[model samples]
Target: MSDFTDASTEPDANVSGATPAPEATPEAGTALDIVVLAGGISHERDVSLRSGRKVVDALAEAGHNVTLRDPDATLLPYLAEHRPDVLFPALHGSSGEDGSLLDLLAGLDVPHVGSAGAAARRAWSKPVASSLVRDAGIAVPASIVLSHESFRELGAPSVLRVVQRALVGDLVVKPASGGSAQGVTIVASPDDLPRAMVDAFTYADVAVVEQRIFGTEVAVTVVDSGDGPQALPPVEIVPTDGVYSFQARYNAGETTFFAPARLDAEVSSAVAEAAVLAHRTLGLSDLSRVDFIIDSEGRPWFLEANVVPGLTETSLVPLAIEASDRSVPEVYDALVRNAARRG
Candidate 1:
C-alpha cells in the first residue's frame, strides 16, 4: 500500500505510538461508531456524499450513533480515539473503494462492514476485477487492458491496429478503476476509438476495452449476515437514449428501474445465485451488489461488483428490498446485529 494516501491523509493519533484497541468482543447493543465515509478526493465525491447521507439517515433511523466524515483520511485516527463498534464506509469511486482505506483499517484491526481492502481494490478496477473474477469461473464480457505507457510507447496507429485486430463489434471503454460510470464510453466505429480511449484515460491511467454484452443489465443487492448471505431482488436498468451515463444515474426519472425486473422465476433465481457466487468468488463479505448483463442467449454475464453500493432514496438496492416486501430498517438492523457479534 502507498505510504500516504493521495496527500489528504490525516496524521495518526497514535503518532505517540500507542497500541490499537484490543480485538476483543463488542458488547451487546453497544453504541457504535457508525462512521459514514463521504466526500473522498475522487470525481464521484458528490455521489459518495449523497450515498453517505442516505446511509446516515438509515442507520440513525435504526437507532445507532452516526458520525459522517468527509474527503479526509482520518478514519484510522478516529478509530484509535473513539472506538466505534463498527464503521460503515459509504465512500464511492476510487479513493474510497480502491482498497487503500480498507488496508489501513485492517492494519489497525478495526472491524468495518464491507469487503476487505484487497477485494475492494480488485473489484473496483474493471479490467483487473473482470480478469480475476472471470478466471474464478464467472461469466464476464471479453475485454483487454491497456496501460497508458504501453499505448504511448506503441503509438496511436500501432495501438489502434492492435485494437482493430483484437476487439470485434461495438466496444465499451472505461477507466480500469472506480465506478458511478464516471469515465466510460461506448464506441460504435473505428473512428470513435481514439476519443473513447482519451475519455477513459480522464479517469484512470489504465483503460479497459470490453465487448458490449447484449441484453438488459441488472444489479443484484445482497446482504451477508453471520449465518450466510442472501440476495435481494434484482433491479433492471433501462436508460433512455441508449446511455446509462452519470446524469441518467443521479437524475430522477431519467432511467426506468424495473424492480423484481420483469423476468421468469427461473431467470431471477439464476441471477440471484450468480450474485451469491460472485460475492464468494470475489472474497467479499458483509455486503455487496453484483451487476450482470443477461445476454441474448438468456445467460447472465457478470460485470464487476460494488463493495459499497449506493443507499440513496433513488438507489436500486433499497428499491429491490421494497419490491421484496422488506423495509430498509430491517435489513440495516440485521447488519448492525451481525457487526455486534463480530465486534
Candidate 2:
C-alpha cells in the first residue's frame, strides 16, 4: 500500500495546481432558484441529507437561492407550486438513484442536474451498468447476479458451490442496487461467502458476487458542463481496515484518499478515458462517478458507476474537483446553469 502522505507529495502534471480555462456556458453570476432534494426514506438518508446541505451551501455561496428539501410526499407539489429554475438532487441509494424521482421531475417539466430517468435506471443496477460498460470495451469483473428468491429456491450450498467454482478467487459481494458500500463484503474464505450473501441480501433483494480485483482502487468523476463529459482527476482510496465499508466512506480519517491517484501518466490517461467512456455508455449526464481497480499491469477494471454520487464533505467527487484546480461551488454552479439552459 502506498503511504498516503508520500503519494500526496508526488507531482503529476495532469492534476497540477494550475487552473484550466473554464468551459463556456451560461454566465456563472446568474442566480437561479434551485431546490436541492436531500433526505429520502432510503437507507442512505443521512448521507443524502449531508450531501444536500453541502450542495445548498455551495449553490447559495454561488449566489443562487437554494432550498434544501426532502423527497417526501410534499416534494412534487412544492416543485409544481414554486417551479424552481432547476433542481439539484443530492439523494443517494434507491430513493434517488432508482430513477423514479427523475421520471417524476420530467413529468413535471422540471429540469434537474443529473442523468435522465431511463439512464439512471441503467446505471442504478450494477449488473446492467457493468454489461453496458463491458460492451463499450471496458474491463468489468466476471460475476453472477443472484436474487434472494433464487438463493432460497436453489439450496444455498449448491448456489455457493457454483459461484465459488465459477469465480475461483476472492470475491466481492454487494447489493446489486445501492451505494455507500452499505452491505458490501469481501469474502476471502469460502466459509465467509454464505455470510456475505446474507449481508448483501439484507440491503437489496439482488446480490452481485464478483471476482475481486486486487489493485489500487480509484474513483474518477465525470462532469458534463455543456462541453461534453470530461473526467476529473482520479481519487485513490486506501482504507485503513482494507475495506471501504459504510463507515470508511462516510467517516473522515477512516480512509486515505490521494487525489489524482498515484498512477503513471499512461495509466492515468487510460483511467480517465475509461471513466468518460463509462459515463457516455451509461448515458449519464451532468455528473457521475466511475470506480475502478488498476491491476498490476495498469489495466482499469470497472467496479461500478454512481449517478447521483455522494457530494458530502468526505466524497470522492469533491476531492477530484479540488485536485483539478476547481472549486465545488463553481462546478455545481455550471451544472445548474447548463440544466437551466436545457429547460
Candidate 3:
C-alpha cells in the first residue's frame, strides 16, 4: 500500500493522511499538487514543452497547485525536495519515453500520469514493442530489426540477403527507438533499402523494417484510473502524402483526422477493447495511446504502444476525446483526478 492514498479517491488529504511528503495545505478550499514535466533530452523537446504548458495551464485552471519542471539535472533534486502529489510526464521520444526516467520516478515513489518503467522501455523500441505485442496475441505486421553498426562492419550485401530472407515486399523502415517519424522511410524496392537503412541509422543504432499492411491507420487512446483501464474512441489517420510522416503529424494541413473512425460498430468496439488489453498486457499505468492498422479483412493489427504519447496542439488524443463530447480541460482534469487516486 502507498503511504499517500490517491488524491482523487481519498475524500481529502486531511482525512486520509495520504498527502505527498511536501508541506501542501489546501488554500481556502481544495488544492492538488501537480508537477508537469516538459523538457528532456529528446528530439521532440519543443513539442514536449508545449504539452507541458497546456497540461500545466489546464490543471492550474482546475484549481490544482501546479509545478512545471523540465527534466534537467535539477529535476530529481527538485522532486526529492518538493514531493508533489502527482507528476504529469508530458515528454516525447528518447529519454522521455525510455524507461530510465520512469525508473527514477519509481525510486522517488511518486505517482506519475503515464506508463510504468518496464512498459515504456519496451514500447520505446519499435521492433521489440511489435514483437512483444504480437506474441501477446495482438495481430501485427511482419517486421525485422537491422543493426547499422553490423551492416557497416559486415557490409550491405549480407545484410540485404538476411533482410530479403526475413521480410517480403514493400516495407516501412524507421529508427527503432525514436518517435515522431524521425528518419523513417518506405522502401518499395531493393534499390531504396540501402538509402532507407542509412537514413534510419542516423537516428538510432537499430532500424525496423516492417511489411506494410493494406488498411486504415488509426490511433486509440487508453486511460487507467483505478476503475481499471478503458479505451477512448479511435482516430483514423489519412495523410495527403499517403503516409503519416513527421510533417503529416506536425504540419497543420497535411492530414485529415476522423474520430470514431468510419468503421462498423463491432469493429470499432473490438479495436478499442484490443487497445485496452494491450495497455494492460504491457503493464503500463495511468495512460497510453495504441496505434494500429486495420487490414483488408477488417481486422485490427497492433503497430506500437506509446507509453508517453505526444500531447501537442495537433495531437490525436484531444481530438478523439472531443469526438466523444469531452472537452480538453475535462480530459486533463480526469487525468488529475486519476493521478490523485494513483497516489
Candidate 4:
C-alpha cells in the first residue's frame, strides 16, 4: 500500500552539512539543583510525566539534585521564591510545546533546556514549520489546513470533496498544533476523510491534511550542547498497525525502532542534513526532533518538527542519544549546564 523502495540498502555516503558532535562529558553540570517540569494540562499529561520522571532520574544520576514539578498554580510563586540552577521542561503538547509557558518562564528569567518562546511557537505549528522548511528548499508534503469553523460552516461533505479532489492520494490528517501523534488519522480512502477530519478537530481547532508519501517514517533528533546543533542518528519507526499513533509511540514493543535507519549512506546523509536545516530554519534552540517520511525516490518529506522532543522510555530522543555514543545523563547534564551558562 506504500511506495516503498529498496534504495535504503545502498552504501553510506558523507552527510553534507552534518558535523560530528564533540565527545560528551558529564562533569560540566554537577551538584546543581534542577527542576524537571512535567504533568501539564494537555492531552499528553501522562506522557509528559513519564518524560519528566526519566529526566529527573537521569539528571540526578549525573550528580545533580533534581526534582520533578508539575505546572500547578503555585509553580510561579515557587520558582520566584527558590530559583533552581536550570529548569528542564519535559512536557509535551499544547501549553508545553506552544510558546505561552516558555514565555512565562522567560518572564521569570528561568533558564530552561529547550527552545525559546517565539521559536517554539514557530516550530509548534505543523503548517508553519512545514512552510518554513519547504521554503528553505526542503521537500515537504503538499497539504492544506482547515479550521473547524470553516469545516462546519462550509459543510463537511463539500469540504471533504474539495480536499479529496485536491489531494488525490493516500492522506494523513492530524491536528495542526499538537504532538504525541494524538488525533492523527491516515485516510487511505475518500470515504474515511470526513471521519479523520472530525477526529483531528477533537485535538485542535485547525487540522492539517497532507498527502501521504509512503516509504519509511523516521525521527531525527537534533541536540545542542554549547556547540552548534547537530543531528543524531535518525530513528526509523515501524509500527505494527502501519501508523505511528499515540499507542505506538508510548507503549513499549508496540513499535519497532531502528537507530541509524537502514538507509544507504547517501540517503542517510540527506536525511540528517534535512533535519539540521529544519532545526536552524525554524530557529529552534537547545533541542528538537524532525520527523519525515522518505518517498520511493529516496527523498525525505518533512512531516512535523517537535520543539520539545519526548524523552520517555520508549521515546526516540533517548534512543538517539544512546546511538550517538553518549549516555542519557551525559547529554542531559550538558544541556542543563548549557542553559545555566546562558542564564
Best by lDDT: 2
lDDT of 4 by residue, 141-198 (tens): 8898999999999998898889988998899999999898899999988888888998
Writing each residue's lDDT as its tens digit, candidate 3 over 130-217 gives: 7777778889888877787878888898888788778888888889888888898988988998899989999989888888787999
TM-score of 4: 0.91
RMSD of 1: 7.9
List lDDT for all candidates, in order. 0.77, 0.89, 0.79, 0.85
Shift in Å, residue 4, candidate 2: 12
Q: In every candidate, how many clashes are there?
A: 1, 0, 5, 3
Colliding residue pairs in candidate 2: none
| lDDT of model number 2 | 0.89
lDDT of 4 at 197: 91
Q: Of the pair 1 and 2, which is ahead by lDDT?
A: 2
RMSD of each: 7.9, 7.4, 8.5, 9.0
Q: For candidate 4, give the lDDT.
A: 0.85
List the candidate 4 regions with Cα displacement exceeding 4 Å.
1-29
What value does the lDDT take at residue 179 in candidate 4? 91
lDDT of 1 by residue, 108-169 (tens): 77677888898897788777677777877778887889988898998978898788778899
Worst 10 residues of 4 by lDDT: 10-19
